[model samples]
Target: MSESTPFRAAAAGRPVAISIRNVSQRFGDAGSPNEVVAVDDMSLDVRRGEFVCLLGPSGCGKSTLLNIVGGLFPATDGVVMVGDKPVKGPLPRDISFVFQESTLFPWYTIRENFDVAFKFQNVAKSEWASRTKQALEAVNMGAFIDHYPNQLSVGMRQRVNLARGIALGTDIILMDEPFAALDEQTRMVLGEDLSELLAKTGKTIVFVTHSLAEAVFLSDRIFVMTARPGRIKSIIEVDEPHPRSPDFMLTPKFSELRNQAYALLRDEVRQAIALAREAEAAHA
Candidate 1:
């Protein structure tokens, strides 16, 4: 493992891009019967340009944590600092999101969608075309610029979605299973594309996913969380560099990391299932 990669050591020396300190999220009033704790006290630092994955059971608040970091909403406790700015609300210029579902407006052409994002980010009109072209070309979607979202297949639209996120030119991207709906083969291909993007752009990424292989393949470090009232169970380092080849997955290190992640989550998954069953019974 030590000879396989130097990313882990290199990551430690990078400046922190995101600082999450004692963060917790709770839904409903404190002490109420309906109160739900989505995240418990959690803290971590994501280094500049590092790709980190939040992986755990279904109800483990991975998405909640991502949203908190992105400032989609406030966390019930603690603080999140992106660079020197404390995240009180959405920092559109510094952050972007790519979710599982395609967020493209069906009526807009691919080019129009990028235009809208750039406009919202207040990027100069002069840079919009160049940014759009570069981003789309990076994802192999430049030819589809004039096509509407509905005109493209799921995978194509996702590529466009990814391209749009990149064209926003943010320093950080928070992704919530952006490739979850795609077929396995398409997902793998997109994963590789994402790796290349990471290497080329050097953007910090915080991704939430349940797939062990995806976590192992794409992350510099994987944060495996416990079930609801989610907390970090373990942080597993992949120790690999970006623009990774699929051939890396054929190696023993990949298998070792994947198996380790699974072992951590297996018990948490069962616990989440049991909690769901209990909730159903109580409602019944």
Candidate 2:
């Protein structure tokens, strides 16, 4: 059996919010020369209200696994469950995504962008204005409702993107390196805001991030993966509570956990580099 089964079994007693069972994703037809197995035989359960981080080297399939969970597409093998239901396609009401870059329409005002999202989600027209206002306010972007995406700074645009996800009223949020493009300072501040939002909303979140400090500070647990054909290498737990402050980062425990995650990842990252080099030489 695969590594994930044991972990899933261990967490069976908890209220699982997302369950992935032996999922694998391949980029090409099976046995084809171009076939690339991005994820291999992975299984794990995300518990209700938990913040889980998928952390690994650059080419590992962290984001791919997240996409499967969000029903962006079906996995090549195995199944994913959101609660007890199988995910056949996007469950807009139950799941939302905040991507690395802002997905806001360039021509629309911030309010119009949210209206579009709600409309797609089949949210009632009467509730659009109130929900949009509340979500924007939550991200401290309420005053910019009339602004276009181009009018906002990169960080502000991301904040709006996050608000759009939140306003969708989904119970689960999948974030694909949402703060990736920001400077370190802005990323940290947004991390704080996300932590606070998590505490307030109790949403089940699955985040993909490469930053060790960001993972250590924001996650309830971190899933460290292997070099490629990514599988869980180890799981690291952070016992801190949410709405975490900057002071938490200064703690000895923070340093210890961060070091633990790094140590687990170091060899895998080296392996990934070697694999990349081999692939390059083969193509050449």
Candidate 3:
């Protein structure tokens, strides 16, 4: 038999950038009727400069977990630590988030959006122009610097959104299905660009995604979550190096990893769908 590869070695002695210890998130107080446990006793560690993906069916609370890690919302139980410090609120200086929706100001030009984001991060005014130019160039959006968000295509807008996040110069970047709205072709292109960007920057990244291929292609490890009251079901390692090529997507190994993830997730997705239908029926 071939020797099995060690999973921990993928991280190769990198320090943990984000740590979630038995974290649980419930929307309402204990014994409350409207309570919803969005996450349940989930523990995860993301190593510095690693790309990790949170993959799951809908309602599995992947975004909720990312939000908690980003301190957009606090967990009801347990704690989150970023680079050895407990996260109690938004850590703008250490973390950046790219949501599924474009949060860019529609009236603002692409460069203006980046300017505003840096302002929010309290970056020095003198550094804004150079930093914005550099980040946009990194994402290949330097040409559209003056275009308003509305004028850009969905793919272009997302590129700008990504640029804005990178311009913040945070050590950790948390993405909540940032490519969900893009078409398959656009997603693939953006994913490739993102993979290259990660390789170049060595920034720690945690991305949330529903696409199995996307997860397999972009992540060093995939964290699969169970349905509502979400918990980590399994962690699958992608043994490939980053700056992954389109040819990798066509390889048998890529499909095998993607299929493994799908197999683990198929039943959970059905259950989530059934639960949603039941809830809808009750409401009706």
Candidate 4:
């Protein structure tokens, strides 16, 4: 339909920006001995400016889903659409990704890394300096504009990685455990910055994370998934506005939402563990 229509008329008047319909991602051939199913028959809709988190146990293909939606690869079945167009391959200008590890080139200065991404996105040279500067300022890393990635601490490097993603000026960002390597305190601070960035830019974000508190703190809605061949088990809404404070975590409501997410994922975590064990035993 038009931009005026919400997916299934469910997402208020916000208009669906990403539509994932019955998408399944697999590797190897079905009925083959080594076949693997990463995601199975899952569907989701992300509205414009929405922050949605995919939370699940190990091997649940949270990252795989993010990859499919970002068009790093197409799904094995079903389709993922950005606006009205089906995602066939990388949409560099429309989507950007920040992964678990810092992706900055070690040899390049921070400014050079932004230039590289700008080239890939076909961003104009005139916009490069302004975009890079604005993104670094947002993440409080403007002082390190000339520094190389190797010179920064892990947390600092990740901040620049996130800034590069922002500088690309995509409407959507897919982050797969981008803060997974950091200490709890650092992750919290970065999460706060991300929330503020979301409020400021109105960009759509699909974040995959394993931390319950992080998911509860950062997400507008958390989509919890089952074990391998991942499928959505629950969708929990934070029901709060953007630029949320750390004080929000101190409230009973935050605790309640976190507990609910844990309850939903606990079984899935166990199931994932059991499946891994069975697979190992069969091989043995």
Residue range 62-124, candidate 4, lDDT tens digits: 989999998988889998999998899999989999998998888999999999999989999
Please give the range of 10 consecutive residues that has the lowest summed lDDT in model 1: 1-10
Model 1 TM-score (2 dp): 0.96
Q: What is the TM-score of each candidate against the true structure?
A: 0.96, 0.95, 0.95, 0.95
RMSD of each: 3.1, 2.4, 3.0, 3.0
Clashing pairs in 2: none
Put the candidates in lDDT order, highest first: 2, 1, 4, 3
lDDT of the candidates, in the order given: 0.90, 0.90, 0.87, 0.90
Which TM-score value belongs to model 3?
0.95
lDDT of 2 at 199: 88
Error of 2 at 146 (Å): 0.5
lDDT of 3 by residue, 1-284 (tens): 01122475356468789988989988877777567788989888888888999998998888889998999878889899999899999988999999888899988888788888887888889989998899889878898889888988888888788888889999899999999999999899889988898888888999999999899999988888999889988888887877889999999999999999999999999989997898788778
What are the per-residue Cα lDDT tens digits for candidate 1 across 1-284?
12122344456678889999889999999999899999999898889898999999998899999999999899999999999999999999999999999899888899998898888888999999999999999889889999999999999999889888888999999999999989999889989989998898799999988789999999999888999989988889988888899999999999999999999999999999999999899889
After superposing candidate 2 on the true structure, give the runs of residues whose Cα lies further than 4 Å from its correct spot.
Answer: 1-14
Task: Please identify model 1 stretches exceeding 4 Å from their true place.
Answer: 1-7
Choose the strongest candidate by TM-score. Answer: 1
Which candidate, 2 or 3, would have the higher lDDT against the true structure? 2
